[model samples]
Target: PSDFSGFTVDGFKDEFEKLVETDSKSIVLDLSKTEFIDSSGIGAIVFLYKRIEKKNHKLMLLNVTGQPYKLMTLLRVDKTIPFVDSI
Candidate 1:
């Protein structure tokens, strides 16, 4: 688990990438704490998911409520990635 609050684009990307490096079966993105997200932020998440998938790991999005969820749905990113029920 990771919290991306107050993190910049590259910082979140870097941290996400680092988390993927660990030999874990699943990575749950806690988007609940994230108050803002730009295009780059979305890109970072997609990148992480792709990389994790390549390694046969799973990625799940959590607590994706409010504006972030709306933005993702509007961008059609929600269709590309699945969301979990609870955070």
Candidate 2:
């Protein structure tokens, strides 16, 4: 979604749950189109990251830019969550 805020966080969480059930080794969230994000969104991402980490997997944020990128950087989320320009 373009807006990864509270309004969309629930959906993200639901998706995360589905991802948890999968056997995939790596998970990448493509945020190229997401222009806005709030604390709830950030929190969800962090939670997803930790969960994936616990599974000894990986969670990568892709194409993070604009305001969302700034907010993530400000919160130092970029340090904890890997951000990639491509796959």
RMSD to truth, every model: 3.2, 0.8
Residue 24's lDDT in candidate 1: 90
Whole-model lDDT values for every prediction: 0.77, 0.91
For residues 1-87, write the lDDT of model 2, one tens digit per residue: 899899989876678898877789999999999999999999998988888888898899999999999999999998989899999
**lDDT value, residue 16 of candidate 1:** 78
Query: What is the total number of backbone clashes in candidate 2?
Result: 0
Worst 10 residues of 1 by lDDT: 1-10
- Candidate 2 stretches greater than 4 Å from native: none
Tens digits of per-residue lDDT, candidate 1, 1-87, equal: 233333567565667768889899888887877666767778888888899999998888888877678788899887868888684
Residue 6 in candidate 2 has what lDDT?
Answer: 92
Q: Which pairs of residues collide in model 1?
A: none
